[model samples]
Structures are given as structure tokens and as C-alpha cells.
Target: MLIRVLFAVLVVVSLVLGYVGLAEYLATSAQYAHRPLDLLYYDLQLFVINSAPVSNGGPYPWPLEVSRFLTPAVTAYAVVEAARLLFASEIARLRARRRARHIIVCGDSLAARTLASHLDAEHRVVRVESARSPAPLIAAGLPRAARLYACADETAANIATVLAASQVERKVHAPLEIHAHVSDPELGDALRDRGWREGLEVDFFSLDGVAAKQVIAAEQPDGERLVVIGLSAFGRALLLELARRRTEPVEVTVVDPDGEAVVAELAARHPFFAVACHVSVVPVYQPEPGVHLVFVCHDDEERALRDGLNAAATVDATRGTVIVRMAELAGVGEMMVQHGQEDRLRFVGVLDMASVYLSERITDSLARAVHRRYVRAQRALGQDVRSNPSLVDWDDLPDTLRDANRASAGDIERKLELVGCRLVPSLEAAAFTFEPEEVERLAVAEHERWVAERRADGWRYGSRRDNERKLHPDLRPWSDLGEAERQKDRNVVLALPEILADAGYRIVRR
Candidate 1:
């Protein structure tokens, strides 16, 4: 707005100066008398083409030359500035579209801002302020977006954003990945369930889950003695994940004012925690020697920071790593970076963790789905696949194969959900039922997914004799498939409903 006003002022000043300066030059020096209207007309012409000869047909007066030079310069400046102002937004939209993969983040919340900051360093990010509607996403170029993050302050706003983005994705068939932020893990799980039912690409992320993963992943093998000084959502999540990931039996002392009741509730919620680790709850912090990790995760940022600092002071600097969770982490992070670097203190922020939680929703889920299919396919081949499909290192998969598998998994999931056999969590939790025909339709979808995965692994169509017994050469549609081949696809689809249940999911009607 300021730029437009400045350009307008420049243009007006130029016009006035051109007319007055040239008119005075004509009257005094050239002795060429003319009407004020005539002088104004001449000045307008001069402004359009400053180098054009003066109509006086005499040596150009000094003032006329000055007017000539100043007029066109300002005129050109105004014209260019006007054009830029008119098309600036369009040009920016075009630039964003040209980026092969870009993310659209909607909302002005801390999570949205943090995500944009993290992503902007590498990927093109278009941020929109509208949290209540999806219109901002469409206006921000949703058709070209590879991912959309809806991280609003309110859960309802985030849900609304997902609905809006889903509508855009359905209309364009653009395969846009949408991520919605939810603080509660159960709510996030329910949203994922709803996503499968809606046949839309949406996932929910929790910052507490992200922080739990981060802290657990940082632990060394020998480090088992840990002190967790809160029973907040994040603290409980950390303890559960720690127990789940621990190979050997471990002990975790939980210091919470809520006492044994909170610990008992958490253990019951996650049965694995009870079987894998010993959790002792105490009323207050007790500094124990050889404590490997100390986590001060409180809802209040100041209290968490103070508790973390106190815990850090008690622990041996060379032996323990202190992890602090703060709603706002800027001051603590900088303070630790400056003074507490030697103490091995780690800081986690509720809002900034959204970047980690939301960034991998699409890719990570795709990878997991591919791994599940791989295990199912291998079992069908009569190979002795392990009880735990994720036992094998997914990171060791070839880049080409992983990419292909993820793409194929995404396509398969979409198609399966479009039909009635959408995935859900357990039989009792199923929101809808899959009909016999819908289950049969999934066989055809699975067959295509198989073919695509095989092709991705470098298999190609060819005659058996020419190909010398190459795999997946006789790829055919479900109708053309013989009973044996059809059975293979059907076997995978038939196993899905129960397999999903065992894997903490089920297949429900779309």
C-alpha cells in the first residue's frame, strides 16, 4: 500500500512539475506565448516521451530540458511500480506452483508458524492465515500443494481445515496430504480413523508423541535409571514409549504429586509398560545417584524450567542427560546454549515439536503400510517372515524400492478406502461394516498394487521363455487373472481385516 501511494505521489509531482516548468520556460526564454491548456497538453506529451524535441522549434531552454528529463523518468517509474503492484500476487502464486513439491500451511498458531519456519529453509512454503475455512488453501494454490498442514489454535478449526482441503483434493484428485494438529493422542487416533472412513488423505499429529520419540531415541543402551518429574500428558507418553522401546527390563522413578494413582492409570492404559518396566511413583523429587536421565515435563513452562534446572544441578554432569519440556522454549534454549552446554540439557517445546510430528505423517505412514504389505506378500510366498514385520531394518531398503512401495501403498490405501473395506482399529471399534462385494473388490485393488510394487522393484512384462522365468511378467487385470493368481490377491485382501485387527486396526465400510 505504501509503495502504491509513493508511486502515485511521484506521478502527480512529475505531471505538475512538467507543466509548470515548461510553461515558465516558454514564457521567459522562448517568448512563445500559449494558453495554459495548450502548455498542459505539451507537458503531457513531454512526459510520455521526455527525449522528444520541444514544439517551440528553437534551442531547448534549460528549464524545458530539466522538465523533459525528470518527467519521463518519474513516468517510467510509476508505470513499472503500477504493473508490479497489479501482478505481484499472481507472480508469487506462479512461483509457488512451479516448485515441484511445496507445502501449504494454514493458520497463525505457534504450531503453524514453527512448521513454516522449519520447512521454509528447504521447501517452498505458502502460509495462509485463515484457520476456520479451507478457502485460504484454495486461494493459496492447494491444487499444486504436495502437503497441507492445518495447525490451528482450536481443534474444531483444524477439523474444519481438513474438511476444506479434502473437498479441494476430491475435486482435483490431486493426492494432497493433509495434516491436522491434535494435542490428545486418542483424538489423533480417532481423526486417523475418520480419515480412512472419509477416503481423504488426512493425518493427526501430537507434539507430546513427537517429544516422547525424541527423548527415547536419544537414550544410550546402558542408560536405564531415569527420573520423570511430572505426570502431564507428555510425561506419560514419554514413559509409555520408553517402556515399549526398551529391550531389557528397566526401572523408572516417577515423581508426581498425583502419586500412585496416576502411575497405575498410565500403566493400565499401556499394558506393555507394566510388563516391560518397573515404575515407582513418589510424592516429590529425590535426587538419586547414577540417574541416567531426568525429565522435567510440567504443564507450566516456568515450573518445568525451574524443576529441570534443579534436577540438572543434582545430577552428575558427566553421567546424566536432562530433558525439559516447556510450552515456550526460546529463553531456556538460548540460556542453556550459552551456560548449560556442559550439563547436557535438552529442551523440547510444545509448539515447535509440531514440525517434527507433522512433517513425516505422510511418508512415515506410507512406509509402514509398505512394510505391512511386504510381510504379507512374503508370507504368501511361503517364506518364513518374522512375527514382527518391522523387525527388519526399513532404512536398509533400496531407495528406488522404498519410493515405489510408498507410492503404491498410498494408491492402494486410497482405492481400498474408496471401496467399503476402509481400515479401522479392531472389530469392536469398527465404525462401519464391509460388504462381501466390497471385500472382493479389494482383491482387484490389491492385485494392481502388487503389479505396481513388482514393477517398482524392476520387474517388467514379458513372455516366460523370453524373460527366462522372470517374476511378475504375466501381469493382468483381476478379470484376466486365473484362479491361482486371483487367489493370491484375494489371500492378501482376505487376510487384511483380521491382520489389521491383530495390528491394532480393522477394515470397516467406507
Candidate 2:
């Protein structure tokens, strides 16, 4: 009511001023020279008040005359407000560019909100564009994203824009990989296809869907590494089990939250051959049984493995016991039969078979599905036919290199016998290379390392425990040193390797 009355007063004042102006204009300047100009600006301002220009234009400077003709004083104040609002909006655009979070999302609003909610835990989100506010997305846990703009609506285009916004926001330091959520299966597939096109990997699975078979299959022969990603616990355990039982290697990268522990443990236990700059290459599985030895070398393959890419260099002085380092293995249980004597080969690895089945959801069938898919892709490429260069090309190397390579090759073929991993044509190198003596040496070295590490760990723990004991005089018993007990577990590290070495298997380094 107060605003309405003030508005009426402004109108009366404007009308009175107009009447005076009209008389003055008629008396002096013919019909007021500025009337036509002011009227044009007023009409344009009235029509385009909400339709603001990117560069210029705003509401009236003489708003009193244009609005209600309240008074010249009122008109001056209105003009100031219009100018201030216009500049303020421009500033908003600049600030948003600097600070806004950009999230590229797909699916219906609900799905977007769901995905947004998940992403919002760690990031701010920009709602691309829509009539309604993205409050649902914000509610779902997504950060507030007020400045929404898009160059295009296509998936690829949207990704580009999101990247742009990310750069503008300087998100590269604290990186956030794009998270896509598509509710519809068909749309999900489409999005995935586009993701690959954009050089991104996408993992997907229904919470309920399950595969049934578990056997690893033969491949067509593309020599490229086959990687299985986004595996569930069941899949990871299955894969790890297959690798454990195999004689060769299979590359696996599990992206499930539950599976990370398995991967970490595997990493800790596995013998790693190469610690290159960016690639922390660790072979996931080795076809050989009773041997998980990773050899580190300054140059040339360690004595256990011949040298270079020459598979021959991989042979151990002790013929039956084989060591594979920096290797991944698959298809071992059945392959073990080909080796002829189970007692001949000793299998040892950083692998814990229990880890394979640790995940409740992991199943043999999913593992087979992942492996079979790779085999199918390879077969489609016609990589088989002895042309699988991983075998022949390395096999065809000059005899000087090929001898050690041949020995290495024998080691691998022999390895298949150990684990029954037959599909992998013996690669002679890490396949069957490892000297038990060298492995023992590696193990001994490892034991020393464990001893040192454990000692250090013991000291660290002892200090803490002793400090606590000092704090509580009553609980501190003569031998009631819990810290000392904790330190004892450090010796557990060297125990396993020693037991394996004592078993008479060669424990070679990669």
C-alpha cells in the first residue's frame, strides 16, 4: 500500500512537470527538441528492461518522467539505480566465470540431480540450463552452480564446455574426473560410446545384473595388452584367483571401491620389475606357480632373466623352478596339467587367494565375461595365425639374443606346465625366467629389507607405547608391552618369503 501511494504521488508530480514543460517548450524550443528522443528511449527501455544487451543499454536515466513523472529528483534516483543494476549484472558475469563450478551431466533432471548430488560432495556444480532451478540437484548434494551457460547441448560439446569451465575455474590442480550419470540404458550406452570417442573410459553395470560363466577363453591374437576395468569385488577376486593359478600374466585394473583394498594388497605383495617415471608397472598374474618374484635392474635383465627383450635371458640356472617378475597371469589351474609334474614347479606370489573371493559380489562368470570380451576383440582383429608378433617377432630375433631369449622362452613354456596357462604362447622372458638361487637371493635381500623396516617400525611403535606406558603407571606391566607385540608383526613380512625359499623354489628378482 505504501509503495502504491508513492507511485501515485510520482505520477501526479510527473504530470504537473509535463504540463509545465509543454508550455515552456512551446514558448521556447518548438515542441521540445528532446521529447522525441526521450520518448524513443523510454519505449525501448520499457520493452527491453528484462532483455538486457551484452554490451550496453539499460532502464531510463529520467525514470521519474518515463515511469510515473514523480519529480526530477525521483527521476535522477531511478536513473542511478538502473545504471547500478546494469553494471552489477555485468560484474556478476565476470565473477561467475572466475568462480563458477561446471559439471557436465546427462539424463533427465532427476538423474542429473542424482549424479549432481554425488559430485557435489567434492565440487561445485553449474546447472547447464533449464527453466526450473537445479535445486533438486543441489538438494541431492551437488554444490550450488548459479552461472549456467552452454556452447552446445550435444554430449561431446557439453563435455568441451565443461572442460572449459573447469579450466576457467582452475580445477586442474585439484582435479575432478568427469562423472556421468545416465538413467536410461539406451542413453547410457550412447553416452558411453561418446565417452570413448572423447578419449575417456566409462564403466557401467546394473546393481542387479550378473554374469554366469567363469572360464578364461582363447584370443584372436592382437598383441596389445588387454585391460579389464571397473571390476566388482567378485570380478576382482575371480581375476586374482585366475592369475594366481595361471603360469603367465594378465593385466587387470579394478575401479570398484571395495576392490581397491585388494588392488593395494596385491600391489604391496607383487614383485614389480619396472618403476618407470609415470607407469608403476606391476604384472598382475604370472602363469608360473609357486613363484612371485619381481626383479629390479639398473640395466640388462638380472642374471635370473637373460637380458633385454630376449626371452632367452629369462632362464634360471635351475631348470625346473621358474620365476616371473613384472608379469600378469591367467588360466593356470588347467594349464598346470600340461607341465606334467606338479611337484616339479614351486608357485609363489604376493597373491592372496582369499582376496579373490573377498568381495561378496565377485563371481567367476564376470571374470570370464571380461576376459572373453578381450579375446573376442583380439580374434576380430585376426591377430592369431602365428603373426601374433609377441611370439614370433621376439622368437625371430637374432640367435645371439634369441639363445637367452630361447632359454627365456623355454622358461615360459615350462611355466605353462606349472600353472596350466596354455593360451599364452610362451613369451620365454618373464614367462619362464627365474633362478631359484637368484630368487633366494632376492628373498634374502627382501628379508634383510623386512628386518630393517620392521626394526624401524618397532622403534617407532615402541616410542609411542612407552610414552603411553609412562602416562599410565598402573597398566604398564613388566612384559605387558603391547608396543613390543605390535613390533613382532613386522617380522611377519620376512617370514613368508623365507618359507617359500626354504621350499626349494628359485626366488628370482625381476
Candidate 3:
């Protein structure tokens, strides 16, 4: 940007100098006496290196001499810049080789674009046309990149891209963090379950999953009675997130023409869906009284907006909020506000949500910090990475494990709400603490939340810990847990102040 500005300034300066120089030369010359317009025309020709200087066997005026050289230099620069633009990809590749710890985003998909946009402000972002192409990946400085995101439109393409990146990492013997976007829920789960290669650090994310988290965070809906008017991927994700956050089962009414099949598919994939939420399928949209929240998640933005507006009109302002899924913000919310529906209508854009997700995950966010704290605690108890798979660093942790940590971190707000407390940005570390009774109550709530999460993940109570069978004795109710197990939850409650403080937040009683 600065270079462009300087180039512009130089171009203008050369033009002005040429004009003034010509005017001065024409005024002082004895052999030539041209009109002002003629002089201006001659000055303009200097840029193409065809200007005739008005000199009668004597040295040209200083201004003319200066302009004569400056004009050609500016012309040369313009030529070079045009060539640079023509080969921008090659130039970017060459420049990328000199950059280290930069972010490399492959593909032109919306997810990739959003991630690049968010990271470019804080980090050097190198974009490549293809994720699976070795040439482009190498040109993008894959070996030098701090992180590589394979966000091609197709899941197979993204997978191939990451695999190619892994080969690059192996050849260079450099550690690279690889993130792949898997849109298919079942495929994503299967990949996560199969796990990445032992030595590679690969993370997978779904667009719907990230957007669902954003929607929930934005709305902060109570889990009393919710209506989801489309059992789309995003809708299912939202339900899963809600279940993960709430200890008690939420009553959700899914309104979709094919709600039965969609709900059945989700239930088959995740048995915990049935255990965590009391969901009822309905064929069509119906305005239900006493609903806490409603989400219009149709893939088509126009349909979503129309349905959302209708839902907003029927839903009582004081009772529920209606959310619409949009690809981008196009002033529909403002129009709703003009119609006096601002309090009830909200829009969640996919790009916006993806941007937030990338920003948080790419940095040392609160979620990563929570995982780090958990790892440290596990290590303090004499657990090693080999002995406990979850004892790995944030980068190496599986996506599911990472999601669990994120869910736990995300639940902080709900836990605060339980005790009439709230989190606000704070400058002081360890500046707040909960009372003894509050700690006990919160600890119990945390335990219940943990139980619900475990149950939702298909874990069951057993006499001993078994990761293979997904069984743990502590999976039972909080009351049934031993004092030692209860203390683990209490310790997390006790660490709330410091953890929140580290994330620049402080808990305050409402």
C-alpha cells in the first residue's frame, strides 16, 4: 500500500515538474515561443520519452533536466508494476519463501476466504489456488508456513491437500499445523474417529459447527422451549452445541418437511442427541406460545429471511428471539428494525461466523488456554502423553477432544448465570473469586455438565476407567462421585478466576 502511494506521488510530481519545466523553458527560449496549451501538450509527451527540449545549443534549464529524467523513471516503474500484477502469483510465491511463521490458505472457498481475511490483519497470509496441487502448496511456502488451512469446496480435495502438506512437512522435517475443512458431518466424524497419523498434527472443522457456536453465543438462548425451523446441518449442530452447554435436557421442536428422516439420521450418528435433548419433529412451522427461541436455518438465504421475518412477527418480543441464517449481512436486520421487529429478529452470517471461529482458533484463545490448563493438571497428576492421550498439546489434540475443551470453556457463561454472576473484560489477573458456597454449587453444576457431556458422547458408568469402552465410574451423578472425583470439579471452579483473568475476563456477581 505504501509503495502504491509513493508511486502515485512520484507520478504526480513528475507530471507537475514536466509542466512547469516546459513552461519555464518556452518562456526563456529565444528560438521557440509556443503557446501555453502547446507547452502543456509537449510536457505530456515527455512521459513517452518524445519531448523536445527548447534549448539553443546551451545547457537545458535545471527543472527541464530534472523532469526529463523523472518522467522516464516513472514510466519504467509503471511498466514494472504492470508486469508485477500480471505475475502476482509467482511474485507472491517468491516473497513467501522469505516469510516464516505465516499462514497459508489454500482454495477460494468461502471458508478459506474468511479465514484468510481474518488472519491477514495480524499475520502474513499466503493464498494458493489449489490445496491438492503440490506446485501451488510448495509455492505457497507450505514448509515455512506456521499453519496451513485446506478449505477446498470438496472434502476429498481438502483431505488430499492436507495429505500433500503432510508430505511436505515430512520432507522438510518441519512441524506444520494443518487444518482441514470437512463439510460432511459423518465423514468428519469418521476421520476424527480414525485419527490422523501418529506424528502429524491435523485438525478438522465443519462450517456448520463453527456457525452454530457463533449463533448460540450471539443469542444466548435459554434452553427452555426452542423451535428450529429446518433440520439442516447448522440446525443439528446448534442442537448439539445446546446439549453440550446445558446440563438439563432442552425441549426442542424441529419444524421441517422432512424432520422425521433428518432427526433420525442425526440420532443414528449421535445417540447422545436423544439422551441430551427432548426433541419433537413437526412437519410444518407452527407458532407455539412460550417458546424461548427460534432458528430459521434453511440453506436458501431468501427463504430463511422470509421465514425468519414471519417467525419474528408471530413470536412475542418478550418471549422469544428469531434467528435467520444468512450468507452475509445485507441490511435486512436494519429493515426489520425499521419495522419495529429489531428486538425479535437477528441474522447470523456464515462468513462472519467463520471469521470469528478462525480468529479464535488461530490464536491463543480462551479455548486453547482451557485445554492447556487441563493438560497441565493431567501432567501434574503424573500422566504422560503415552499414558493419557488427552495429555497432548493443544495443536496435537484430536478435534473431538478440542471440541470438548471448547464446550467446557463455552459453558463458563452458563455457569456464571447459574450463580447470578457475569464475565466482563478485566485488566487485573486473579482479581475475582467465588465464595465457598458458590464454589460448591458451581462445582456440582460443573460435574453435572461433565456428566451430560460424557453421556452425550456415549460414555457410560463402569467400575473402572476404560477409554476403549468409553466407560468411567465418575460418569454417574455428582452425588455418586467420590470426594476425590468431586474435588476435580471443585478445583476447576477454584481456577475460574485465574483462567478468566488470563483470558482478560473477570467474574462479577450480578
Candidate 4:
């Protein structure tokens, strides 16, 4: 931008200098009689190296001589810049194709653009205008890309790009991590559960889900009473995320016109809804007393803001917060602050939150480390691919399992808090350890956390372990677990320091 500005200034200055010099030359010299407009026109011609003002000149003015060289140089620079602008994308695409381990973002959608913008400068990002065909993906360097994000506006387009990328992955005999943006929660769930091509690891995510995760992380909304207004996709995602994070059942009231249908849909999709939350549905928007957090998730930004404001007015300022879902924060957020409701009224932008969380989740070092540790542990136990399906590499692991690992990684901070320790950034190698009693306590906590997670995922205790039926023998109480099962939890607890260290963090007793 600064270069363009300088170039523009140079062009204007050159043109002005040329006009003044030509005017002065014509005024003093007896060569030609021309008007000011004609002088200006002739001065403009100098830029293109066109007709010179002087036919038979004895001497030229200093300004005229300067303009004579400056105009043409500026013209040449303009031409070169134009050419560069025209071919920059193509050049970048070609270079990206030759580069190995680069990230390819295949889409021009908001999510894709946002993700591309948020990506770290360390990783080379190649963006395709659209993902309607495999040609663009290949052109964007899909074959050599370490990761591909198919974030087209249409879910179908993202799926098509994923399939194309998978075929390329198979042909090249190289691994690729593909993340597809599926807006519909049910479709995202179904696609994830159905699984994808073997050699290529595929994951599906929704804007709402990402936004919900961001909101929970930022707000830490763990109140006893929660109210969700407007049963939009974001609302559903928020409920699910809340359920996943909460260790105990929380009272939740969902206010929407189609409350019954929404409740039924949630129950059908997630059996763990009943286990993690005590929920009630109400058609009318009522300000429930003692509500800790209220999420206004209307699809319409204006409606969401209006409801959020109303909730903010009634809810206790000290105890409650109203979070409104917004497409962007510019107009609505300022209005809230102006109205002095900034403290209690918060807004979450879908694209902003989604882009941030999506990038972090996809390239999460801690989550990758967690998966690697799990794989190592499984291998140490002599478990092969046939014996354990999750005994594969991080890229080859299914999305569900990957999410579980990510969830476990996400809980490390909370686990650290339980042991009176906190994670702090560290550049050097971390060699921290927990006390023996602390490790045992954390192990118990980890086991209980795992059991809750399993139950919330619709798993049930059974005599035999069955993945197909969502049954596991170790789903019983921590006391009922054999020493082997208990040891696994203890191992994870002990490995906390190493895991945190790998992710550039070290545990420090608080």
C-alpha cells in the first residue's frame, strides 16, 4: 500500500513538473505558441515518450530535464507493477505447487478467507478462488500440501473438494489432512460418523460449533442456571459444548418458538443431552430469575441484539451476562457500550470466532502431541492396527477420535488447576513433576472426567467392549476399574508436564 501511494505521488509530481517546465519553456522561447491546456496535454505525452515540446532547442530548463527522465521512469514502473498485479496469483500458485508441506485453503468464502488471514506467517498458505472442481485444488498445490481446508460456502462443494484431494493423496502416496466446513450440524455429524477415505484424514466442522467453543473458552460460563434464547444452530452448538465441558449436570432452559421440535432434535442427535444437562423448553421468552448466563442466538442480528439487550436489562448485573450472536461487532457492540451495557452484554461474531478456533484446532500442537502420546502408549502395550483402530498416526485417526484427543488436551489447564499448578509459556525444555499424592488425585480426576465424556457420548457400561454398540467394560466407577485401567489414567496424569512442555508450556505450582 505504501509503495502504491509513493508511486502515485511520483506520477502526479512528475506530471506537474512537466507541465510547469513546458509552460515556462513555451513562454520564454519563440518555438511555438500554445495555450495552458495544450501545454498540459503535451506534458502528459512526455509520460509515454511521445512528441517533445522543443523541435530545435538550445537549452532545456532544469525542471523540464528532470521531468523528461522522471515521467518515462514512472511510466515504466507503472507498467511493471500492472504486470506483477496481473500475474501475482498465478505465480504464487505455481510456486506453492512446487513447495512441499504448504497449507492450501480452497475457497473464497468468509470462513476460508478468515482462516487464511489468521494463519501464521510461518506456514505458506495458497488460496484457491473456489473449490467447485479438483482442478483448482491441484492448481493450489493440493498434492504437496500438508493440510487442505475446504471451506466453501456450500457444504457440497467442500465435500467434493475433499474427495478430489483424497484421490490426489492416494495417487501421490502422501498423507493429507482435510478439514471440510459443513454448516449443518446434523450433516457434519453424519459425515464425521460415516467416515472418509482411508489414506486421507478428514474432519468436518461448523461455524456455529467453532463460535460456541470460542464463547465458552472466553466466558468460562459454568453457572448453575443457564438460559439460551433462540434455538438457532449456534444455540444447539453452545448447548453441546457446554454439556461437554461441564463436569456436573446444569439446569438449562431453552427459549424458542419451536422449543419442542428443538428439544426433540437434540435428544435424537445426542443421547448424552439428558446425562449432562437438566433442560426445559419454553416457547415464550421469559426472564428466568437467578439465571447466570443467557445466550441470544437468533439468526437475525438485530433480533439477537434486541433480545440480548432485554435480557441484560432484567438479569442481575453482578451475577448474569447476556451473550448475543452477531455476524460482526462493529455497529452492535458500539451501541451496547454507548448504552453502558458493556459489562453484562457481550457479543460473539460467528466468522471471527469460527476462523480463530478453526485455525487453532486444526494446527494445534498440544492436540497433536496428545495423539502422539496416545499412539506411543498403545504401541508400548503391543497393540497393533488390528487390535486397536486408534493405534494410527494423527493424520490417519478418525475425526471423532481426534476430537476426543483434542478435548483431553483442552482440559489440561483445568486439570492443572485442580493440582494447584498452572501452565506458563516457556522456551526451554520443561522438567516439572507433580507430587505423588497430587498425581494420584489428578489420576482419579482424569478417570472420572473420561467416564463422564464417554457417557455423554452415549457410551454405556457393558460386560464386553463394543465400539459398534457404544459399549465399554471400563465405563464403571473408578473403584471398579482394574489396575491396568487405573494405570492408564495415572500415566496420562504423569505425562502432563511432558505434554505441556512439548507445546511450549511448563507447569508451575501456583
- By lDDT rank, best first, the candidates go 4, 3, 1, 2
Instruction: Report the number of clashing residue pairs per model.
Output: 2, 56, 0, 0
Model 1 is weakest, by summed lDDT over 10 consecutive residues, at 424-433
Candidate with maximal TM-score: 4
User: TM-score per candidate, in order?
Assistant: 0.61, 0.24, 0.63, 0.67
lDDT of 3 by residue, 231-257 (tens): 777887888777666666778899988
Q: How accurate is candidate 4 locally (lDDT)?
A: 0.79
**Least well predicted 10-residue stretch by lDDT in candidate 3:** 168-177
Q: In candidate 3, how many Å is residue 91 off?
A: 4.1
lDDT of each: 0.68, 0.32, 0.77, 0.79
Model 1, runs deviating above 4 Å: 1-60, 90-101, 169-174, 195-199, 220-223, 247-249, 259-261, 326-335, 338-342, 349-510
Candidate 1 per-residue C-alpha lDDT over 295-318 given as tens digits, one digit per residue, 9 for 90 to 100 = 888878888878877887788767
- Which whole-number lDDT from 0 to 100 does residue 192 have in model 4? 75
Assess the local accuracy of residue 461 in candidate 3 as a C-alpha lDDT between 0 and 100: 89
Model 2 TM-score is 0.24
lDDT (tens digit, per residue) of candidate 2 on 364-456: 212222233333445777876365423332212333333432332233223323333332211112213333443334333333443444344
Positional deviation of 5 in candidate 3, in angstroms?
8.7
